[model samples]
Target chain A: MESLLSYAFMQRALLAGFLISITCAILGVFLVLRRDAMIGHGLAHVTFGGVALGLFLYLTPLLVALGVAVFSALGILKLKERAGLYGDTAIGIISSLGMALGIILVSLAGSFNVDLFGYLFGNILAIDPEEVWMALILALVVLITIVLFYQEFVFLTFDPESARTSGVQVRRLDKLMAILTAVTVVLGMKVVGILLVSALLVMPAAAALQVARSFKEALMISASVAGISAIAGLVIAFYFDWPASGTIVAVSGLFFLVLFQARSYRKPAQEELNERV
Target chain B: MSTNSSLIHVDNVSFNFHGLKVLQDISFSISPGDFLALIGPNGSGKTTLIRIILGILKPSSGRIVLMGEEVHQFTQWQRIGYVPQKATLLDPYFPASVREVVAMGLISLKRFPRLLTRQDESSIDKALDRVGLKGLKSRRIGELSGGQQQRVFIARAIVNGPDVLFLDEPTAGVDADTQARFYDMLAELNRKEGLTIVLITHDFGIITKHANKVACLNQRLFFHGTHEEFCSSQAVQDLLRGEHHLVCHRH
Candidate 1:
C-alpha cells in the first residue's frame, strides 16, 4: 500500500474511487428502493455512447459524455411519462441503442485501441488529477441535490401516490433524480467503468438493507460499506496488480453475502417469537 | 367557486381516456363534516373519480373544486389526505420503521432536511396514536400485518392533520375481522373528529351503517343522496338488482 501511494496514478485512482463510492451509494439506495437499479446499468451504457461520441468528435470526452448521458436520461424519463413503455423497457431500448452507437463510434474513431479499452473495463492507473476534479464537482452537485431533497425522495419512494397528492411535485423530483443519476453514472464510468458501475450503485445498498431497519440507517450503512470496499479493493489490487473495479465489486458482493446471512440468522429468533404469539 | 360549508365540490366533471368514457357528466358536492362513500361496479370509474378529485388526472371536459379552490389550481394539499388501494402492496424489503413511515405524511408540511421539529414529532406521535400503532413506532413497517399496514398507511396520511381524507379501497386486501375494525376506526374519525371523508369502497353493507351520503355510479352518477334517501332512490335500487354480487361480496 505504501509503495502504491508513491505513484500519482494510484493516488488519483483512490480519490476517484472514494468519490464514486459516495455518489453511487447515495443514489443507489434510492434506485434500489425504487426498483430502478437497472437505470444505472442503462445509463452507464448511455455514457459509453457519449464517450464514443466525444472521441469521434475530438471533444472533451467527459463533457460530451455528461451531455449525452443527461440528454438520454431525460429522454428515458420522457418515454416513461408519455410513451406506452414500462421503465425497464424504456431503459432497455435506450441502453442498447447507446451501446450500438458507442460501438459504431469507436470503430469510426479508428479501432478498439488501448485508450478505448481503458474506458470499457476501467484503467485506474490512467486516471489523472483533472478527471478527479471533474468527478468531485459533479459528485458535489449530486450530493447537494440529495441532501436538499432527501426527505422528499424517501416519501416519493415509499408511496408516490401519497407524495403526489400531498403536492410534492413528483414529476420534477423524478426528473431531478434521473439527471443526478445520469451525471453520477457518466462520471463514475472513469473509475469503475461502464460494465460494472451499476454494481457500485446496487450491491452496497442491498447489503445495508439486509441489516438496517430504517431508511436513514440503511443509507448511512450503505455509504460506509461502499466507501470501505473501494478503499479495501484498491489496497488489494495494488498488491496483486488486479483490476480495481472488479475487485471492489467482488468485495462489496462478499459483504452483502455476509450481511444477508446475518439477517437470516437473526430472523429465526423473531419467527419463533411470532410463532409463540 | 368555494363556500365555507362545502369542503369539496365536483361540478360537471367528465373524464375520458383514449376515447373511452370513464366518467360522464358527473356532478356532486361534499360538505364539511360529511362522510361520503363512492360505490360502483368494477368498471364504473370510481378510481377515476378519486384521481380527478385528488388532481392526479386531468378531467377531459369539466372541472372540480377541492377545499374551495379549483382542483387544477389548488395548492394547499397538506389539508387533504389520500390513501390508495395498493397501500399494502409495498415490497417486503422496503426498510422503514413505523415512525418514519408516518413521518412521510409530514413531508409536504416541512421543507428540506425534514428533521422533525418538536411539533412534528408530536404530530407523528398523535398520528400513530390515532391509528393505534403508538407502541410499534420503532418496529419495521414491513413487519406489520396487512391490516396493521393499512392502519400504518392511514397514520401516514393523517400525520399532517388534514381536514379531509380520501381513501381508495382502504381495505382492499384485508380480512373480514380486520376490515370491520378498520371501518369502525374510520367511522370514529368521521363522527368524533368530524373529518370530511370521501371513501371508495366495495361493501355497501357497511356504507349504510356509517356513511351519511352515498354515490352509486356506472359510467354516470346514477345516485347521489343521503344514505337513508339512497335506499328510496330508484337508480341505486336498479343497481342493487343489476350488480347484486358486487354488493353482497365483502372482504
Candidate 2:
C-alpha cells in the first residue's frame, strides 16, 4: 500500500475512483428507487457517441461527451412526450443510435484509434489533473442538486401523482433529474468507463437498499459500499494487475451479493424460541 | 351548518382530455370544517374533479378559486394536503421508513436551498401520533399492513397541517371493518381538528354515517346537497336499484 501511494498515477486513480463512486452512489439511490437505472446505461452509450465525435473533431472528449449526454438526456424526455413512448423505448432507441453513431464516427476518424478502447474498458490510471477537476466539479453539481431538491425529489420518486397534487412541480423535477443523471453518467465514463458505468451507478445502491430500512440510511450505506469498493478494488487491481474499472464494478457487485444474502438475516432464533417457550 | 367559511369555490367548471368530456359545467364550493363525500360511479370524473380542485389538472373552461385566489395564481399550496387514490401504487419493495415518508410533507413545504428545521421533526411526530404510528416511525413503510400503510400516507398528507385535506379513495382495498375504522379516524380529525376534508370514494357505507355533505357526480354535477337531502333523493333510490339512471339535478 505504501509503495503504491508513492506512484502519482495511483494517487490520481484513487482520487478519480472516490469522485466517481461517491457521486454515482448518491445519484444511484434516486435512480434505483425510480426504477430508471437504464437511463445511466443509455447516457453512457450516448457518451460513446460523444467521445467518438470528440476524437473525430480533434476536441477534448469529456466536454463533448457532457454536451452530447445532456442533449440526449433532454432528447429522451422529448421523445417520451412527443412520440408517446415509454421511457425504456426511448432509451433503447437513443442508446442504440448513440452506439451506432459512435461506431461510424470512430471509423471515420481513421484507424479506429486504439486508445478508444480505453474509454470502453476504462484505463483509470490515465486520468490526469484535468479529468480529476472535471469529476470534482460534476460531483459537486450532483450533490448540490440533491441537497437543493431533496424533498421534492423524494416525493416524486415514491409517488409522482401525489407529488403533483402537492404542488411539487413534478415536471421540473423530472427534467432536473434527467439532466443531473446525464452529467453524472458523463463524469462516470472517466473511472468506470462507458461500457460498465451503469454498474457503478446501480450496484452499490442496490446493495444498500437490501439492508437499509430508511432513505437516509440507504444513502449512507450506498455511499459506503460504493466508495469502499472503488478504493479497495483499485488497490487490489494494482497488486494483481487487473483492469481497474472492471475490478471496481466487480467489487461493487460482490458487495451487492453479500448484502442481498444479508437481507434475510435475523437475530439468532433461540432468543425468539425462548420468549415463546 | 354554517357556510360562511368557504375555502374553495368552483364556478362553472368543465374539463376534457383528448376531446373526451370528462366533466361538463360542474360547480361546487367547499367550506371549512365540512366533511364532504364526493361520491360517483366508477370513471365518473371523481378523481379528475378532485385533481382539478387540488390544482393537479386545470379545468378545461371554468374557474376555480382556492383560498381566495384563482387556482392558476394560487401559490399557497402548503395550506392544502392531498392523498391520492391508489396511494399504495408505489412498488411494495421501495425502501423508506415511516418517518422519512411522513417528513416528505414538511420537505415539500420547504423552498429550494432551505433545510428542514427542528420544528419539522415535532410536526412529523405529531402527525405520526395522530395516525397512531408514532411508535413505528422507524419501521419500514412496506413492513406495515395495508391499513397501517394507508395511515402512514395519511400522516404524510397531514404533517403539513393543511387547512383543507383531499383524500381519494383512501381506504380502497381494505376490508369493511378497517375501512370503518379509517373513516372513524377521519371523522375525529374533522370534528375535533375542524379540518376541511374532501373525500373521493365510490363506497356509500361511510358517506351516510360521517359526511355531513354529499356530492354525487357522474361526469356532471348530479346532486350536491346535505346528506339528509341525498338520502331522500330519487337518484339515490335509482342508484341503489341498479337502474340506468342519470340524474343531472343540483340543489
Candidate 3:
C-alpha cells in the first residue's frame, strides 16, 4: 500500500476519490431525504452534453460540463415549480434533451474520440494533479454551505410549509442546493464516470439511513461509508486491475446489503422490546 | 376594524387554482389572543386560506396584513408558528430526534451560520415539556405514536414562542381523547400563555367548548363572528338541524 501511495498517479486518484465520495455522501443525504435522489442521475446526463460541447469547442470539458449541469439543474427545478411538472417528469425532459444534444455534438465532431470513453467509464488513475485540487475546492464549498444551512435544510426537508412559514427562505436555499448538486455531479464524473456518478450520491446515504437513529448520525455514517468504500475500491482495483468506479459502487452496495440485512433481523427484536415495555 | 389589535388581517383575498376559484373575496381579522376555529367541509379551501395567510401561496388578488405589515413584506416570521396538517407530509421513517424536530421551529429565528445555542436547547426543552413529551426528547420522532407525533409538531411550532399559531387539520388522525386533550392544551396556550390561534378542524365540539371565534367557510367567508353568534347564525342553525353539514348554506 505504501509503495502504491508513492506513485503520483495513485496519490491523485486516492485524494480525488476520497474528496468526491465525501462530498457526494453529504449532498446525497439531503437529496434522498427530499425524495430527489434521481436529480444526480439526471444532471449527469446533462453533463454529457456539456462535455461534448466543450470537446467540440476545444475548451475544458470539465468546466463546460460544470456550467451546463448547473444550469440544467436550475432549469429542472424551475420547470417543476412553474410548469407544475412532477419532479421525475421534469428530470426526464431535461435529461433527454441533454442526451440528444450530446448525440448531435458527437455527430458534429465527425468521430468518437477515445477520450469520450475515458469519461464514460472513469479513468481515475489518470486523474491530473490539478483535478485533485479542484476536487478539494469543490468539497470545501459544499462543506461550508452545508454547515451554514444545515438546520434550514433539515427543516425544509421535514416540512416545507412550516419551513417557509418560519421564514427559512426555502426557494433561495433550494437553488443553492441545486447548484451544489450540479457541481458535485460534475466532479463525481472523475471518480465514477458519467454512467455511474449517481451511484456515489445514492448508495452510501441509503446504507446509512438503514440504521441511523438521527439525521446527524446518518450524515456521519454516510460519509464514513463512502470514504471507506473509495479507499478500499482503489486498493482492490489496483491489485486486481478492476475498474475503479465499478469497484467503489459495488463496495457501497455491499455495505447497503449488510446494513439492510442487519436492520431486518433487529426490527423483530425491537418490536418485541416495545411490546414488553 | 383597527389593524393595531389584530394579529392577522385578511382583506378581500382571492385565490384561483388551475383556473378554479378556491377562495373569493374572503375577509377576516384575527385579533391578539383570539382562539379562532376555521371550520369548513372537505375541499372548502380551509388549507388554501391558511397557506395564503402564511405566504406559502400568493392570493390572485387582495392583500394580507400580518402584524400591521403587508404579508409579503413581513419578515418577522419567528413571530408566527404554523403546524401544518398533522404528519401528512412527514415521512414515517424520517430520522430526527424529538429535540431535533422541535428545534427546527427555532431555525427561522436565527441568522446566518445558525447554531443551536444553550438558550435554544432550553427553549426546546420547555416546548417539549409544555407538550408533555419532555421524557421523549432523545427518542426518534418516527418512533412515537400518532398522537405523540402531533404533539411533537406542536412543540416545534411553539418552540420559538410565536405570537400567533395556525394549525391545519391538526387533529385528523388522532383519537377522540387525544383530540380533546389537544384542544385543552391549545386553550391553555390561548388563555394563559396569550398565544393567538387559528385552528382548522372538523370537530364542532371544539368550536363550542374552546374556540372564542368561528369562521365558517365554503369557497367564501360565509360566517366570521364570535362562537355565540355562530351558534345562533341561520346557516349554522340549519346545519345543526341537519339541513346540511358543516358548509354554510348560502342564501
Candidate 4:
C-alpha cells in the first residue's frame, strides 16, 4: 500500500480522485436541492458528443467535451425559459439528442483508436499527469465559483422569485450554476463516466444531509464523505483487482444505505420527542 | 430612499393567457407609504397583476412605470421585495436557519463572495425583530410553525430594507390569532417605517379594517379606491357581500 504512492500513475489517480470527490460533493448539494440531478445526468451524456467530436477532429477531448457540455446546459436553460418547456423535458430531449449524435459520429469515424467502453464505464488507471492537472484546474474553478456565489446560489435554490425580487440577478445566477454544473459533469465523466456520474454528484450529498444540522455543515460533511469513498474505493479496487468506477459507485451506494438505515432508526425517537412536546 | 412621486404607475395594462383575457384596461398608481390590499376571489388575476408589477410578467397591451421610469427599463430589484403565495412549496427539511434564510435577502446587495457585514447583520436583526421572530433567529426554519415560517419569509423580505413589499396570501393556513398578528406587524411596518405594501388576500374583513386602499379584482379591474370609497361603491360591495352571502347560505 505504501509502495503504491511511489508510482506516478497511482499518485495521479489518487490526486484525481480527491479533486473529483470534492467537486462532485459540493456541486451535488445544489443539484439535489434544486432537483437538477437529471440535468447533471443529461449533461454528462451530452459530454460524450464532445468526446467523440474531439476524437474525430484530432483536438483535445477535455476542451471539446467542456464546450459541448456548456452548450447543452445553455440550451436547456434557453428552452426552459424562452420556449416554455419544463426543465426535465428540456434535459430529456437534449440528452437523447446528444447520445444519438455521439453514436452516429462514432460510427462514421471508423477505425479510430478509441475505447468506447472506457469512456462509458471509466478507467481510473488512465489518469496521467496531464489529466490530473486538468481535473485540479476544473476543481479549483468550481470551488472558487461556489464560494463566491454561495449565498446567491442558496437563495436561488430555495426560492427563485424571492431571490429575484431581492435583486439576486436570478437569471444570470441560474445560467452561471447551469454552466458550472456542465463543467463539473464533463470533468466527472473522467472518473465515474457518463453512465454513473450523477451518482458521484448526488449520493454522498444526500447521505450527508441525513445527519447534518445546517447547509454549511452538510456541504462540509458531504465533501469529506465523497473524498473518503473515492480513496477507499481506489484502494479496494487496487487490492482486489476490481473495476475502479464500479467499486467507487458501489462504495458510495453502501454509504447511502447505511445512512438511510441510521436515519430510520432515529425517526421513531424524534417522533416520540415530538409527541412529548 | 428616493422621495420620488408616483412609486408605481400602471397605464392601461391588459393581460391575456393563451389569448384568454385576464386583466383588461387596468390602471392604478401607488405612491410611496401607501398600503394597498388587493382583494379578490380565486382566479381573479391578483397574482398576475402582482407579477406584472414585479416585472415577472409583461402586459399585453400597455406600459408600467415605476419611480418615473418605464417598468421594463427598471433593472434594480433591490428596491422591491416579494413573498410568494406558497412558501410551503419549499421543502420543510431544508437545512437553513432563520438568520441564514433572512440573509438571503441581502444576496443582491453584496458583491459576490464577501461575508456578511455589520450593516447587513444589523438590518437582518432589525427585520427579524420587526416580524417578532428575533428570539428564534437561530432556529431552523423546519422547526417553526406555519405563522412563524411566514414571519421568517417576511423577515427575509425586509432584510434588504426594500421600499416596496408585495405579499401573496401571506396569512393563508395560519390561525386567526396569528393572522391578526401578521397583519398588525404589517400595519406597524407601514406606519412606522413607511414601507409601501401590496398584499393579495382573500380576507375582506381585515382589508376593510386595516387597509388604507383596496382593489377588488376579478379578471378585470372591478374597483380601485380608498377603503371608504370601496365600501360605498355598489359594485365593490356587491362583489364582497355577494360572496359572503353565498358562503353563509352554503354553510
Which runs in model 1 stand beyond 4 Å of their true positions?
A: A268-277, B1-4, B242-251
lDDT of 1 at B116: 78
TM-scores for chain A over all candidates: 0.94, 0.94, 0.96, 0.94
Report chain B TM per candidate.
0.93, 0.92, 0.95, 0.91
Worst 10 residues of 4 chain A by lDDT: A268-277
Clash pairs, model 1 backbone:
none
Q: Backbone clashes in each candidate structure, one number apiece? A: 0, 0, 0, 0
* Whole-model lDDT, model 1: 0.85
User: How would you encode candidate 2's per-residue C-alpha lDDT over B216-240 as one tens digit per residue?
Assistant: 8889998998888887888777776
Candidate 1, which CAPRI tier?
medium
TM-scores for every candidate against the unseen true structure: 0.94, 0.94, 0.96, 0.93
Residue-wise lDDT of candidate 1 within B184-205, one digit each (tens)? Answer: 8998998899888889998877
lDDT over C-alpha atoms for residue B170 of model 4? 90
Comparing to the true complex, what docking class would candidate 3 get?
medium
* lDDT, candidate 3, B1-251, per-residue tens: 56788889999999999899999999989999899999888999999999999898999999999998999999999899988884644676787888889999998789887799999999999999999888888877777766778888999999998999999888887789878888889999999999999999888878888888999999999999988788778877875576434433211
Interface RMSD of each: 2.7, 5.6, 2.8, 3.6
At residue B155, candidate 1 shows an lDDT of 91
Summed over model 3, clashes come to 0
Residue B244 lDDT in candidate 4: 60
On DockQ, the candidate that comes out on top is: 1
